[model samples]
Target: MDPQSALPAQLVRLAQEESFSPQRVLDAVHAALAPRTGVRRAEVLAHERGRLVVVARAGEAGPVPGACATFTLRHGGAELGLLHLHGGDPSTVDRAVGAAAGHHLAVALRDVTTAREQAELHRVTDAVRRLFEEGVRAVSVEAAGRLLVAVAADVLGTERAAVMLVAPDTRVTHVLGVGLPEELEQRLAASLLGRLARDSPAWQRAALTGGPDVVDAGGGPPGRPGGGVHSHRLRSKLKLPLMSAEGLVGTAVCGDVTRSRTWTPADRVLARRLALQGAVVVDNARLRELEQAHLRQLEHRAFHDQLTGLPNRAALLGALGDALDPVTGDGGVALLLIDLDGFKRVNDTLGHHSGDVLLQQVAVRLRELLPAGATGARLGGDELAVALAGPAADLAADLARAVHARLGEPYVIEGRTVRTGASVGIARAPRDATDTTGLLRAADEAMYRAKRAGDGPRTAR
Candidate 1:
């Protein structure tokens, strides 16, 4: 039970606990001193913020002399603090116990300080991860920026936070945040970040070099320009360059009222991690938007004919089925089939290109001539069809006549005027045939009947 022997063991135990507060260190020191010989009470007093503060006191006895041990927790070879003991008789063993306890206490306090720093680093890392995950839900750049600012404020222990993004071409900075002071926000939006976006050598250097940098209030580093450039009167600042594979994206700046807030190596590491995650989220959102747009275009193309930009065969069939189901419950459906009589002659005389133009022109005219309830389709080659209700044969005849007249007009195809006519066939549902297949067969037979009738239109009963 030698005090010196027990001292190292106690210090090791204290180090393992990972408690680094001043109060915890003092408590450990008092506990170590309590079991030593001739020691009634032990107290530790240290200078904190230029004032003597009692960090730890133990034992039910009175206070000891303040000058017993001499140590200051200041910089540059300064002693840590004082350890006072009240007891009966002074001996070599008693003095050894006090010295040993003091030594162990100092070591314990240093370990505690290191542990606190590590714990703070872990906390900030976790927070940044959460922020990045939450940012994934952001639908726009402004929302993402606001999330970044909120995360920064929580991690850095700042009263307010703001995020600024530099426009690529305009070189203008935009403020995106949730809780920002009015004065700082206005100044940053109007001058500070905007000026940096406009022309700050430091910002430009960091952006171009693709690295991180820091600056303090009152223009801590020289070489930066004045006026709007020096608008931010921050006590300290930390700037990180945002980058992607293509190039630098932008810069992330954090400021606070703490003097030149010296960044730890851990802080820099965490900041870089956050910036990379933010970049990924933004990139993913953009990719999703592009994919949605591409899918819409493909859907539109799938439902329409590429050449005529009208409903194609498949769409026409689907429309026919839908139209027949309701009208079939009553009388039946009606179909009109039209074949361009001399379209092949035009293709042979002009060319396939001119033929395609003539077909498109024919489609337009047919669409205009058809009734409101009629659906039209280009069924390969020069064949076209229109479908309507069963009781509309007279109306169908009127449409067929109009279509024949329209087809007879001269078509200016690729600067060459060509004339064409159409042979029409009409078939009525329930009267000609009941099912869709039979009705289409009847219409096709009637169409050839009209063509054989020598340029006159015909209808099948």
Candidate 2:
């Protein structure tokens, strides 16, 4: 059987194997051509730099004719190489067979290249996802950017990578990178950092087109003339927009040359993927921070009274319990229950609005008279409670005098002088009553006792 006759089957088998290495295809071609023309040996030569280079050879065939059968490997009108079979006559049949094999080889090579590229894309995607997930766990944007840059550098075979975020108000681009040069950082900050953030034509184009912009850094667009800075240092740079469902978030830039370098299509694709992952990580981190802040605010509001901005009844009780704990020793917790005497009469004489002002004034006095160790809460209309810790009798007398003196001073509300007095009842913990509720009741009873005793301003029991 002529080797030329077997060329088609051999080429088909090679294509079926899905191996498109240049050397492997050449080997198959050589095998098919060896025995077909009664030639002792055969060789397959590929066109390189306008001349044939022997890629694969077999048998003892002497130098074959240069013009036997020339087959060009082409796809979409681009010539990749030419196939030259040796150790055979330059026959019409040989040319036809070589042509068929060349066409199949070209198609196979294209498919293999595409598959390889797709597989690489999937790998990179998985890596970026993992990086972002790790960033989310750490709750640090810098850490996330570091991982992103590290991955990009590894993928693109470059030394440096950077992630820049546009500030919300100033629109300045802030570098969020693991290992970026100081010069690059400064330049980005002083020049393109903020000035070109939201308005840069290159950035806008990438964001709108959903593609990357490659610039031979320092080459295009003249910088300050006679300036000390050399633009040529930044040879190649790739700018990839970080986009999310909300729109463009920021950009990821990577380069090899400290001053400049050239960028490739593969590098752009990888940078864009990293940017996408980084945006998600950053967004999630910010949301978590916001949620935590909101939760703290809610907790604060829960334990505080809104009207007076003071600790409420619930909070007062908690504080009393802590103060009265046996572990706290005999520090002595004192409770004073205060009632506004003749407050309703004032509300009846003036309007409710004026009464509200009077009540606010009274709350202020109580807050001032109460010591730092003490807390006060409004126990509903015309009534309030103050808790403190000190020597029982002395604290009681001191607080009662303070409240009476402050209240008697009077308040000027809406340009009118208003007068009010408080009747106070004092009780001590573990001395007057055991628990918080009992202490409060004891204090209330003492207050009424003072009111009945006809004691005017400084009455306390």
Candidate 3:
């Protein structure tokens, strides 16, 4: 118990032992002190990231009789942990000797912790690389999320993991998880995501991309929606913001379901890396969708009349080609080419804008008069064409009559009543011509004949 006798104790000789570990040193310290000073128990504890965790213990696991002295072990202004001697006479152990051992032990703890981190990083490098590349190869945001959840569960050493997508307005739009219960996932989406939004001063704590947050809930039962709570399940959780140069995308989360845990700095670093990589994946998918939409718009514009929103001349020719294909197409085809008698004069008198309105109205009438298996198109100013298949072409004359009625009806252009007439030309395939070009030529000639004769419509065989 004397201070001088503590000079040559087991703590000092621990360095020479090749098999010395933290636990071995703790046992040795307890053995030397308990026998000499009559202390019943000892424990080494460290406060890391605001949590007091037991590092090593020797002797009684049950409650000690009394709290003796608490020794502070620190090095370079950092508090490593505390060496607490429980029970027995406090003055019987040499305080100076314990203090010296604690200081030396603190240095060792730092080195050992750093080495452990390095070793773990080496072990998980390949797994982390796959997670990062999964984002690159992901076909969609949902696909990326599935990969992220699985990778997070594997990397963080937990049974459950999830990715919650947040909209620009801070709404959790979607939730994806692996090994997470449906009810628990829903609860997390509302409660955990809400807490992250509210408590964060960052993922912007105000923006969608908040900072990383890890919590140790001490293995308690999460709130049940409408049912009574029973056993404790989810304990520790880590949530990191999924962010990229494009801004906040969502959040990545994982947790231990079997036992309680506190996330260490290494765990946090891994989560952040995964979240960021997954963000790129999501952003790329969004960009891809936008590009696809734009391409669809371009394709529509290419084959459609922008003015009247109808198929253009090229589309009409395509329809004619399809209708005239002997093997695949209907047995016979008909082409109706209509030339407006007074539309040019109206365009010349009115401005182009008024002419456009008249054309749009003409398109509307054409669409209304168009039969179910027919193609209608504006073949350049005042010249419109209609193509129909075998059975439908039998109504070509009737369709021409309907067109005459619809076009001859007064059009209200710019609040002024305007009247126009149409000269119709009808040509049937295998009678007038079998090919689209010849059929169209015959229709044009017949239309001219109707125009010259000043009759309503004319049919060419």
C-alpha lDDT values of all predictions? 0.65, 0.65, 0.74
Q: Which stretches of candidate 3 lie over 4 Å from their true place?
A: 1-34, 37-39, 55-58, 72-78, 89-112, 115-298, 318-338, 349-351, 367-376, 386-408, 421-460
In the range 61-121, model 1's lDDT, one tens digit per residue, is: 5555432433334322555566555663334344555455556566544554456567867
| Candidate 3, 94-151: lDDT as tens digits | 6676665676567656655666777768646756688767667765667777887888
Tens-place lDDT digits, model 2, residues 1-461: 67778778777776777455556765666566555554344444443323456655555556644444555678778765555555455463476776766776666555654666787688677768776667677444455556666676666665566766654432744565435567656655565555545565555666778766666655554323321122213356666676766667667765655544555455566666777776776666556756877887898788777666667778878878877888873588888778887789788988888888887788787777776777788777877778886554357668776775677677888988887778878888777787888888888888887667636432323
TM-score of each: 0.49, 0.53, 0.57
lDDT of 2 at 105: 60
Global fold similarity of model 2 (TM-score): 0.53
Q: What is the lDDT of residue 207 in candidate 1?
A: 62
* Candidate 2 RMSD to the real structure: 9.1
| Candidates ranked by lDDT | 3, 2, 1
lDDT of 3 at 250: 75
User: Best TM-score goes to which candidate?
Assistant: 3
TM accuracy, model 1: 0.49
